[model samples]
Target: MKRLRIISFVLSTIVFSTTLLTTVQAQGDKKSTAILDAMSNKYQKIKSFKAIFTYTPDGGKSLKGDATVKGTKFRLKMAGQEIFNDGKLMATYIKETNEVNLQDFDPSAGGDLDPTRIYSAYKKGFKYAFLQERKEGAQTFDVVELTSTGKNSQVDKVQIQVNKADNSINSWKIFQKNGQKVTYKVEQFQPDVAVADNFFTFNAKQFPGVEVVDLR
Candidate 1:
């Protein structure tokens, strides 16, 4: 009877220890979550901004673009050629042989891309951990990581440089577990610019003999 009591006490002690450890770990996770959410909140507050961007991959030709943002309007294009997508913008592009027209958009496309809205919906889509400080030309930054929440998402893990002076995202490096990787470097950020009302319009009459695909 004494042996039975001893065994029962031992089992109870083990269970109690496990429960305590589990509680501690859960608390730690919650605290970590709060830190990340704070950073994301700062990210979502910008109404408009601009930047000069360059992208270079391991073995591909570098591409450059000027990125302009006005409220939810966005325009990103490379030299005279580009692939542009905007949810709240209308822009025009005309070439000797072709022309493109755009209408305002809802900006959220099937959850792939949302300006700072990603954090509000999928805060855990990224893992937030700090890295060493880095300083560049007139820019000091802290690194935060956003990795695929899924095992098979083709997009790679992204490392973003948060500008120390403004708390804005400045640059990105990508690491693909299942695909190719790229690095996007934004050199300049302009937060002041008046975006015209017609900046988000698609006028086919403006460009005759041009293919007008409705992407709205």
Candidate 2:
């Protein structure tokens, strides 16, 4: 469960942070704010998106995952488990156990377990600054730093690299107070993909003999 929570939170940071950028306040270095605004504008135009990413924790093995998101709905697959959130309920299915845990989804809850609150949490506790422009191959990236303002916050800092040409996130590294760091990089991104709303909902009929546990 702990691993699942961490993966979900990090994935949400990569996915929803881009989609919900407009809600973030323009309180940062002028350059950083401008860049963020541009990125926000670009993602706001996307009705839906699918992203493939890899995340590695400090001194830990790396794992790759994918997520499909539209509005407040998202379906994430990683580490032999799948999580579905339809802006109403959340279902976490474990393939090995063939068990699904269901719970009510609440975006207003401010915590790491709540994927939808990630952006709001960042907005509330972090301040952004423009770092520098980085070049790799033929692509240039805008590097930005987010420092935690609250002493009690678990996050020490975060560094994000945004692709200059497309205004998309290339990667992000989270630094925790315990000296642990996790890096997440986007391997692929597909925007404005056509998907039905039901894709974000888990249907029991799809998995025969699966045990459903209602935790709501």
Candidate 3:
């Protein structure tokens, strides 16, 4: 019965290994979700916030921009584009074409990286893993890696670095399937900044001679 014992031992080893792997994966998933929940909880409580960020693209020049988020309303200004969303309406102005595209604000819409989608994006269409914790100077950052759950997702993976002390997102990197990488680093953040309701709406007078293209 030595052969029978050997077979039983091999089967038991395989079962044990599979269980161990599953448990480890579950623990990692729990950790990643906890980190994301902490960040979302903190940001959801904030009334209004403004942040200056540096955006760097792969093999492209870095650009500096500012984002102001107030509830579901947000305004994003970048090098060639300015996006304004006032909960109901969305306006995207492209400087190169001198055209503004207006659409109904749909949070479930894909392909755009608006400020409204930052925190909540991970909650859906993503499988997250707690990569590791990195210590830089006096700050400790919890790095979480996310892979797109959708087969047709434009982005392949995303890495988010969150400050452990303040539970704030310090930076995030987006890796596209085309091998392009975009990184955004938060330089300055001001929470509870006073913002008017009309600040998120686009005004025709502000653009001067820009053409409005309503695609709604």
- TM-scores for every candidate against the unseen true structure: 0.64, 0.87, 0.80
Point out the higher-scoring one by TM-score: 2 or 3: 2
Residue-level lDDT of model 2, residues 1-216, one tens digit each, is 675566455544554533352265655889987776676667767778898899888899989989888888889998788989898998989899999989898766534313443433445567889999999999999998888887766678888888999888788898888898988888998988899999999999999999998988
On residues 135-173, what C-alpha lDDT tens digit does candidate 1 reach at each position? 988878877655666554444466667666765556666
Could you say which candidate leads in TM-score? 2
Q: Each prediction's Cα lDDT score?
A: 0.49, 0.76, 0.70
Candidate 2 residues lying further than 4 Å off, grouped into runs, are: 1-4, 17-25, 110-123
Q: How many collisions per candidate?
A: 5, 0, 0
The positional error of residue 162 in candidate 1, measured at the CA in angstroms, is 1.8
Please report how far candidate 2 places residue 197 from its true position, in Å: 1.0
Which has the better TM-score: candidate 1, or candidate 2?
2
- In model 2, what are the clashing residue pairs, if there are any? none
From the highest TM-score down, the ranking of the candidates is 2, 3, 1
Candidate scoring better on lDDT of 1 and 3: 3
The true-versus-predicted C-alpha distance at residue 209 of model 3, in Å, is 2.3
**RMSD after Cα superposition, model 3:** 15.8
Q: Candidate 3: minimum summed lDDT over ten consecutive residues — where? A: 13-22
lDDT of 3: 0.70
